[model samples]
Target chain A: MNTDWKNIDAASLNNLTLGEAEKLFGLEPNFTEEELKKVRNALSRQYHPDLNPDSGNIMSKINAVYDILKNEIKNRRNAEQNNANGGATDTSSTSSDSTREEPEAENINDNAGATDNSTSENTADEPEVENLNDNAGATDNSASENTADEPEVENLNDNAGATDNSTSENAADEPEVENLNDNAGTTDNSTSENTADEPEAENLNDNAGAANNEPRNENSNITWEDVNRIGVENLTLDDARRLFNLEEDFTENDLIDAYNRLDRIYNPMNFPIGSEEAEKNRATMNSIYGVYTILRRNLINRQNVQESPTREDTTNQSTQVSMNPTNEKADNSRNDNGDENSQNIPSADNEKNDGQTDRPKDAPTHNEKPALSTGPTVGDQIASNDTTPDPEPIPVIKSIPAKIMDHRKQILIIIGIIALAIAISQAINLTLVAQMARNGNLWHLTAGVAEKAALHAKNINLTSKLIALKSSYDSLSGVWTIAGQKLLTGNLQAILRGISAGSGILGLSCLTAGLIKKKSAAYKEYKKNIRQLIRDFNDLSYDEAINQINSLRENINNSNELSDREKQLLLNQLKKAEKLNRQFEDIDQGEELEGGMSL
Target chain B: MMVDSIITLANNKNYLLLMESSILDDSYFLGVLLDDNMEPTVDYVVLKKVEKDGVVCAQQINNLNTLTQLLEEYGSEYAENYN
Candidate 1:
């Protein structure tokens, strides 16, 4: 073999020769010539791909190992030479096999059953040993430098001793399942045998293509990308090109109907009908019919594949599908896109209408002919040039416009977000303030007032009891004076009337004083003022309520006509009522204004 | 004979694998492929194990793709045509 083989791992092969291969393959005690041939044949036969084509890489490894051992006399001799220097490894090998070979009980039974081919097997191995002996004198086998165009190597058919024979039997016996790789060794890529292998590859691909329409199975990990690539690669481009020659038949009626419909519906003027774009569309529509024709032809081709007869009617292009209606529809469609395009680029259309072409004359032009050699053909040149944008260098405005668009989009989005936030906050605030105002707390204040009224009623009760006792004392005095005078005199009656009058005046003054319990309220105006204060407070009129409460308390404290006890009671009551009013004044609604609470 | 049941049993979890090892020695796409997990497939049929005895095995079965193509197109048709 040439030393410079491509892709061989030089280091790995070198080690196999002298380094550690024997140790690695667990063949430390070198194989005797006889043993090596047997192992090499066994391994090679086991993995030979042809023996088990389905084995894939498993057989290749076995084949590879056979290569190493087949001409391995050089390596075995290397070890034998090592032993000539009296190495213990060499002594062990001779010593061990001798002992094992003489095992009388096991040897006799094993040889007895094995006699079916033992004599022939031993004879078969003799020539191989002679080769090894020859190589011992000269380490390199002459076979290594043999002719490059080597004849095909025969499969070692001594398959029974060679593991292959057993597996083939194994494979044949079990028809239900295929045997795995000939042997365990990994094999190489099978690309070279194109003719023999092509069948399997196609089978796999066909299965893959139809697999898409089949329900998915879990073990199948194939993906659409895999199938699509396979479909494309496996496709015979030649087939498609040939499809053009096939007869038309599959969608005959429908194609004709569509053609007729388009002819009637379309308006050609709307299309700018003679324009290149319209012509291109027209070409595309014609090609579609071409595809339709091709597809119909394929139905027959497909039918052939299905082993079915082709549909025979409508041959020779007799049924020309009506092309009129679709032609009209195509024109109408052209008009719609034209109008939309013109509306979008009014400047272009407007210039065209003005008879001044849309092309800017002063624009820098590249790869362009001058429109004017001051030539009469300037109009034609300008129109043609206007229809095609000058292949000029990229414009500065293009970059600037892109940047401006990005910034514009970003700015608009940010501003829109900010506006939404502001509107949301305003709405939430309005809702909360409305809710707070409606919360009134009027009932809570009414609750406070009821408590105050209960206290005042207690005070009034005590005062009235005192006044009732005083009236009884006056009545008794009138009775005593009468007892000392005439039994039914007019003077006695007058004295009793005077006592009653004094008691009524005393009671009325006490009641009036008690009712005006607080200092500043003009008692007659108290209800109206207090009510107004409550209304102002609920309406967020806090400052006004505070002003009124303070004024009432101040005025009451300063008043001089009251007794010390009544004044103290009035002050106490006013202090509590004012405290409640102040609490309302300090109700910070959590919103701040530039000025104090608006009234 | 086994695993028609096994085929049914292989369920979604089972997959068939057949790889050519000879490619690793030299073939561009084939040689380097490896399954680190080492879960071997039972269903696939590997043909012409890549290399054997210091020679590439696939050299013997060239034009494999063609045979596969013929079978795909003609296999079913033959069955129906003959039927």
Candidate 2:
């Protein structure tokens, strides 16, 4: 059915549901983005203002409904994709868990085979014991024939009975061993118990393995009860390593691998939802993940300490350090053991060691003069001991001139708008002036009427002549006033037009300057050379820094690398640096400043 | 006949005849003055047939407020069609 475009108002149209919107467009529900676009285009063409003059409201409603349907379709597709991704992750975890179970099953089978062999050996010893008993009985009969043989027969019977007792004890031990193996297998196979015990066993094994310097693959002797007594919070770094099934001296990569393996096996998604196994797996996963996070944070902090540079060693290398404000803010934040850093590591177990691990444990205190107190800043390596040469700097620059030129298009558009507004204002003013000139004495009708009444009371001939003379004078005066007003308006318009033109020219010049700077080979080479010089400033002596600054000034003046404007900008920057250097000298002469300066 | 004469007069004067209605045997006409550009301007006026001396002529109703009210009533009625 077709909707009557003329009858539907915007309010009622907006309240239409998805099905109603589809009916409006003559399409089925759950249309694709492409199909919606095609239908929308057809409807747009049918009701467009150019084709149908009275269709503005209708066309707008059509577009609004089109957008609603398009967004709905897009959201549905996004939700489907997200669900697919979640399903894929669950599948991968389940597959990995199954693979892990295969090895455990093999281990259980091997244990069962050992128990069976032991049972077979006990059975073999039974027959031998029986034979010995028979032989002792025969000896006992012979001893009955002679009183001297009775003592020997008694000793033989006792020996044979002792052998039978020993064999029976061995047989009883074999069943107990088999029962223990069976219990271990049951613990591994039982979903709820295995989920709870395995992680704990692994964590304890991790600690035991570390203490014994054992390989990761060694069988765990520690029980889940021992781990429960120690508790997850009190677990040590070795426990975390064991939880990941890692050796004592594992690298970051090894830790990552172990974490991935445990994560897959213990992932709750691998189990049925809301089940006991899932809940237990979730708890175990959280424990493992928390331990892993703490260990990794400690490892990273230790690495940062070793890699940091020493300020004392670099003292002879450079006296002046260029500390940008951005770098200082970064260093202050990095060194500050505040709430923000604590929030970054969000583990309940980690909270216990917050004071110890929040900052680098090995990092020197404030009283001790550390080489480099914080992480390195971008583009400024103040105390780096790296011997390799710095790479070539990128030619990208963000100078003030370049930034202004970036808005050249917007500037041009603004100038054009201003010009158009001025022209329209001038046109309106001139139209008013022309209208005023045409109306003339019509504006002063009341005054004219009053003058005519007085003229009629006086001599008729003289009054008419005087009235004619007055009318001519009034007309001339009006013309002069209109001309003066037009002149004033014209001058104002010219001044505004001149201002607009000047701004347009300024914008164009900025655009040209930006383009020249970008394309200039000399500018590129200058930037590359200056970057290297700036990087070396932290390593140069005070006098050397001064010499370098002077040489840079001379280079700007002598070289054809930069335009006059660029040279001026560079000179201004150098002046700031020179002033800073003088301030440093004053500080050296015992004049302390409250805060430091940054470039 | 009065309506036909008013229409002819309005055409000759270049006035926009906005609305007309008949009640009993009498007809009422509403129109607005047009400027030199032929666009509507100034107040609207009511027109009716009246005999002045011996000749029948279309006379303008001079009550500007009443004419304005009538124009507003007509404007509201047709506003939905265009907008």
The candidate maximizing TM-score is: 2
Q: Please list the C-alpha lDDT of all candidates, in the order they appear.
A: 0.25, 0.34
The regions of model 2 sitting more than 4 angstroms off are: A1-231, A307-599, B1-83
Q: Tens digit of lDDT per residue, candidate 2, span A1-599?
A: 38676566543432345566678777776567667766765664466432344453455456446644554564465556767677543221123222123322221222221243332332333221111112111111111221222232223223322112222232233332223223333112222432342332322222111222222222232111112222233334433443444433456555543443333233333333345433444434444444554354334333445453333222211111111111233223323433222121112222223322233333332111234425532111211212122222222111111112233333232222222222221222211111121122121111222232223313323322232223222222221222222333444332222222223212222333322335456654654455344434434555887898899889989977678877775675566455545533443332221111000
What's the lDDT of the predicted structure labeled candidate 1? 0.25
User: What is the TM-score of model 2 when looking only at chain B?
Assistant: 0.49
Candidate 1 CAPRI classification by DockQ: incorrect
Model 2's chain A TM-score stands at 0.20
TM-scores of all predicted structures: 0.12, 0.18
Q: A51-136 in candidate 1: lDDT tens per residue?
A: 33333333223323333443344334544676686765533223323323321212122222223233223223322212212211
Clashing pairs for model 2 are: A206-A242, A310-A371, A311-A371
Note the clash tally of each candidate: 61, 3
